[model samples]
Target: MPSRVLAVYDGSGIDGDLYTRVNRWAQSAPHWLDELIKVWSAFGLGLFAVFMVLAWWRARGADSAVMARVLASPVVVVVAYGVNSVFKGAVEEIRPCAQIHGSVALETCPGTGDWSFPSNHSVIAFAAAASLWFVDRRLGWVAGLFAALMAASRVWVGVHYPHDVAAGALVGLLVAVVLTPLAGRCGPLVDRMRAGALRPLLGAGELPLVGHGHSAYRAQQY
Candidate 1:
């Protein structure tokens, strides 16, 4: 069937045209490549979950400033999700697969009424990567790399359009940038958590503790 015609923001129908071409390309790709993209699209974000744990583990026994930043990562992600949700509601674009007739997406089409202007997967992945960057530049770069791939995978799997992922990535990065400084101001609270009963479980004794003034991005002991 011919791809369904949909109206774009400018009434140019670019969104429909691009979605059809991209979806066709994905359908024609190799079976292995298609499966790989599908797997990554479904499960790749778990890598970042591991990164979150590792970030906390490495920050154990570190100064309050560093610890605070690491702990605040999940919070930043939560806030980013909220921001993504707001954008989705405002834009209200349906999933590309839903808009296009006879779409052969690698994954099953998502249920109706789920707007797709900004991809939630991209939002979460980029948000986690961006927050981790503030904690450890090296590991942050690794997460950022995967985050980029995750964004692309969403389009490759035919669930989202390029613009949807782009908007999501922007929202995720913006959320991290806007929230990190505010999270930094909570150094004292982090210090208290470090000194409390959870210290051992948080891997405090695994490494020597470092102390410094509460400057959010204080030099690392490592």
Candidate 2:
């Protein structure tokens, strides 16, 4: 069945070409808003880094045995990105904002491929968020909502269509559900590792606790 989104794009109602709209938006890309987006994106990255530092901090003085589990959980985040990348490559669906929209908003776009299938943003964010959950369930749920907001924001901004958001949200949720649990199971072992050699690192912890009680990253994970 052809996607109704596709049908909408194919609809004859589009009054102008995407390029024309993009050109128009380019004329008014507010300096502050553009800066805001860049800042938010950067903030998210910063938060993620903070989390990793904290993760290491906690298990710093723990037993080496827990290292495997603790490390594996976060490593799963890497795998999550790989999975999302594969799916993104597989689906070349154009971004909704770029498709049949009479005018494309250039400021909202990266001037990249309109291929907005399952949102990579959604998938990757959830992956990292979910991975953290295994360490702390409350944090996990919070991260899920956080990730969801980010995904929804993409759609709200007109860069992604409703279906694009839907697909991305769905994929992200699926990844969280499947991969996160495995990471959580490593909790005890991770705790053990944190108590041993990793302890010195935590005892001597210098890096700012990004946000969470344990670490900046875990409480306010990207």
Candidate 3:
């Protein structure tokens, strides 16, 4: 279980400036790049929650079966946050922001409490993308850019390690791959329940050939 935080705590630090080599290049970026990075990071990560809610709202339509499947994906995205919770607390990996270099202009997290393991930002961002990917590959491309921005911005912000973002991305993809079809499996039952196409939402969890591999939805149906 993710350790419950009674109050805010200071973030942890790296054992040493282990990535001094990489830092050299990271510091070379102009001020505009960093500012742009921060902005993109905000959009990439922050907007994911917004997207899911919007998608959920937009998902309501004539095909309830599709809606049920589509809705299931965001639910998995929500759940993946929980899954990250378990390992994130257990791992206790320090963030890069705590490292404190002269170039990286970041402050202590103003409100977002410190708990960086698998990048929840990356996970949700990608989850949002994967959900969209299930609906349309073109939009999925945009989602991919957004997810990548979230990961890169974390590094630029000096808050999360590259590996943290990588893990988050994988987790996000995993959530979609696992959840998409699981929602689909209920298609027959959903159709039966509504007696027809009730709402026209896409299948919620990742559909095979949509995001990541595996068909958890298919497995559950039988």
Best by lDDT: 1
Q: Model 3: C-alpha RMSD to truth? A: 8.9
Which runs of model 1 end up more than 4 angstroms from their true locations? 1-12, 202-222
RMSD to the native, candidate 1?
6.4
- Pairs that clash in candidate 1: none
- Best candidate, TM-score-wise? 1
lDDT of 3 by residue, 1-222 (tens): 455532223232332243343445557878787677767766656676666556556554324445555657668778777877776776655555544354243434422445666677888888778876664466567777878888766766666666778888888888887887677676666555444454233333322333345643432211
lDDT: which is higher, 1 or 2? 1
Worst 10 residues of 2 by lDDT: 7-16
Error of 2 at 54 (Å): 3.4
Question: How would you encode candidate 1's per-residue C-alpha lDDT over 23-124 as one tens digit per residue?
Answer: 788888999989988999999989988999999888875656667788889999999999888777666677877777866678988866687778999999
Instruction: Write down the TM-score of every candidate.
Output: 0.83, 0.59, 0.66
